[model samples]
Target chain A: MIEQYLLHLFIIACVYAILAMSLNLAVGFTGLLNLGHVAFYAIGAYTSALLAVGLGVPFWGGMLAGGCMAALFGYLLSFPTVRLKGDYLVLGTLGFTIIVEAVLKNWASLTRGPLGIAGIPKPRLLGLSLSPLPAYALLALAAALLTYWLLSLVVASPFGRTLKAIRDDEVAAGALGKDTFRAKAKALALSAFLAGVAGALYAHYITFIDPSSFSITETILIFSMVLVGGTASLLGSVAGAALLVLLPEPLRFLPIPSDIVGGMRQAIYALLLVLVILKRPQGLLGEDTLRDAWARARRRRKGA
Target chain B: MDILPQLIMNGLIAGSVYALMAAGFSLMYGLQRFMNVAHGATYLVGAFAAYACARLAGMPLALSFAIAVLVATGLGVAINQLVYVPLQRQKEKDRALLLASFGVFLLVEAIILMVFGADVKSFGLPVRKGMDVLGAVVTPVQLVIILAAPLVFLGLWLFLYRTRTGTALRAAADNEAIARTMGVNVRAMTTLTTALGSALAGVAGILVALEQNLEHSMGLPAVLKGLTAAIIGGIGNVPAAILGGYLLGLAENLGIWYLPSGYKDAIAFVILILFLLVRPQGFFGTRRREEAGG
Candidate 1:
């Protein structure tokens, strides 16, 4: 039983790790605060879940479809919002989340509304279906590792440098002949695609999909993981995910009511977020070099 | 015509709450340039505190409300000192601060849930019967708020537009560095703005609880609506925020009445999106400055 629970925890952490990394790509690497990222996650989950359950598609195909759909939506959304900056972008993303949530809840014929979609089939590998515990844990771990590897590669590449350049100063990047809009669109699409993949994994693993699961609360949780782990850094996402996912399970063992336990878990995460921001707003693993560069850039702009 | 008048009355009552919520939200945005996602949590805290004082202390509803307001004011100050100040001094990423505010919001809500449980808690006071005015039927609390909201708006307007402290606040919000260079205490201004904004959120929460049932999640919708109102009115304009709140309230009530109830929350977002696309400057915002393009 304990081993089974550990596997469940591991899988959950892996899913969150994917989410954190995706957000880091947009916010940390591109410097765009897309608060409605969960909309993409929801799109992926619903897309994959519907394909698998309604159409009898294989899990792999469903996951791919989910990622593609999310990326497509991200690309579309970026056309309008990518032109805006800072708080405006934040508002745009937030609006996206609310609109998506409304659609999810209202489109009951497709989504089943608050009742949710359940009994999703497990992924079959080599013509064999493993127990959900091992199946989901392995899948999540693989995804997490792959996402981290991909993100690290992207962050280290010349394209990654350009993204960082855009993040630091879009005007400078534009002046340097880079297409600022295209760069932001690409980053947002990549981030949304990964988030959708994570959502697909979560849907199949949890064997349920509901509008409630993808609310602003989940967005906050993902944001906490990224902030705690340090935004824009690969290792930061993993560490933050692991800590946030596992911390609450042990707390659940205490002799508290379920509601209270849930509240305590939220509280612990919140306090951690506050403390982290108050002390090391850059993140635990984020280097000072990045911050100093930003400060210098701001100073330069002010002087200019 | 009767239905219209009744809807209009309902809108006015709802608008008062939105105005209260947005006033603080806009003020905080102006001063700190940070989105306090936790503003909703402060609203919940105020409601719960009021509920608790009324239930546990056996205080009169009015006194309990006053106590709630006081507690909420204290919470606002605490948030500013503990969260906003530290973050500003550190000069950390705004995203981090945003996440941190969300954390505080969740934490405070969780604490409320632990104390109050998941069930919706009420003041245990009897629901006041409605009064018929010409063609519209309105409850006493709703009537009070309808009257009080405009008064609050007027009072806030006078305070901000007519007072010395208000001038300082506006100066600091317009440009903190310039204000500091000019010998204005930017730190004090930020702290005061946060405190005042939070207090407004708390008061709004209490008023909302008086009209509706109190729940841990009430803050989420309240804050979201308040944000929508603020965005529509202009993020930094005091009078614009008040007008935005009423307009949003009317839009929401009318939307729910005419459209499917499920589309209620979506109404705000729809308006927000339309505004973002058509007029990002908002109702009262001045000319759009050059964006950073990042």
Candidate 2:
């Protein structure tokens, strides 16, 4: 039973690592800062859940379909808000996130509303069930490693250089004969795909999926993980995810009341985020620093 | 009972609240160009502060509300002094500011949960009867909400148009660099905007709490609606925010007549998406400014 508990914790960490890595690709590498990323995760989870439960699709197929569906949505969403900058872009993505939640909650026929889709079948591997503790843990670990490997490859590629250039300075990148908009849109799609796969893994591992599980609360937690690990670093994503998952464990032994425990946890994460952003804007592994950005803002102000 | 008139009345009352919230929220958006999501926390603080006064302390309703508004404004200024001002001193980027604001939101939410618990609370005031208004049943609290909203807006209008500080605030919002060149204290204006915005949000919280049940979770949704309305009217445009708020409230209420009532929130988001896609500048914002902002 103790081993099972540890494996469960490991599996949850692996899931968040995948999510954080994917978000890093967009935020740290591509500079989209798309707050609506969790909407894709929710879509992926719900899509996989529905496929397996309602249509009898296999796990691998449902997972791929979920990734593709989320990618499609992410790509489509980029076109309309491609011209919006900063706060406007954030607002656009936020609108999408809220709409996704509204659909998940109100469309009772498709999503089963707030009750969420249940009875998700566990994945089978090598003609064997993955429901056992060790098997599921191995599956989660493999998926996370595969995501890291592939995302690192993408980040190290020549196209990745173009993405960084755009993120650093879109006009300069455009002047360098790069199609920054298309690159950003593609990066968003890839990020969404990975996040969706993570969502699928979560759905299968937990064997239950709900709208509430993917709310902005989850997004903020994911954001904290990414920030703690430092943005734009694949290894950092894993470290951040694992660290945060374990961070709350010690609190369980404390004599705090049950009512304020959740609040305490949230406060911890929030405080960490605030400290990290204020003191280390680039994160634990990333390159951007608040001081440097401040200098740039000063220069721009003087120029203006 | 006439469904249309009743919906319209509901819409007007809700619009008033939304406008009040939007005006406060948009002030920061215009002047400082940061997503101060803690505005939601301020709204929560306003409602809960009133709860603390009226329900917990047994203060008279008018005094409780007055104190709530004051406490909320103080909370807003506190957030400014602690978070916004420091970030500005560092010349922080928009993303950093946004993240910090989210941090404030989370921190405040935790505090609220700790102090108030998760259970819902209210003033538990004596029940009042509804008055007939063009075939619509309107309660006194809601009527006061409807009336109070515009009076506050008028007050805000007067402050912006008739006051020198308001002109300086507008200048800073229009172009921070230019405002500075013209000898405007951009930091001071930003701080002032934060205070005004929080005050507006505080009033909105009190009015809405009087009409609806107060919960710790109430802040995010109310501020979100205010955000939608602000975006609809144009993020930085104050008067336009009022129009946007009314439009959202009306759209949300009347939309349930044709679509399922559960889709009311969806309708607001749909409008937001449409506005974002087609007219990113919104109703009052200039097209040129959108490109410039990008």
Provide the interface RMSD of candidate 1 in angstroms, 1 decimal place: 2.2
Model 2 lDDT tens row, B79-163: 8787666676464367888888888888888889888888877667678999898889998888899999889989888999899
User: What lDDT does the true structure give each of the candidates?
Assistant: 0.84, 0.85
DockQ of 2: 0.63
Candidate 1 TM-score, C-alpha based: 0.93
C-alpha RMSD of each candidate structure in angstroms: 4.3, 4.2
Off by over 4 Å in 1: A287-304, B175-184, B288-294
* Candidate 1: residue A223 lDDT (0-100): 80
Residue B181, model 2: Cα distance from true site in angstroms: 5.6
lDDT per residue as tens, model 1, B151-229: 7677777878899898888999888889889888988888788778887888888888777888888888888889889
Looking at model 2, residue A175 earns an lDDT score of: 94
Report the lDDT tens digits of candidate 1 across residue range A31-70.
8888878999999999999999999998899999999999
lDDT at A186 for candidate 1? Answer: 94
- The weakest ten consecutive residues by lDDT in model 1 chain A span A282-291
Which pairs clash inside model 1? none
Best by lDDT: 2
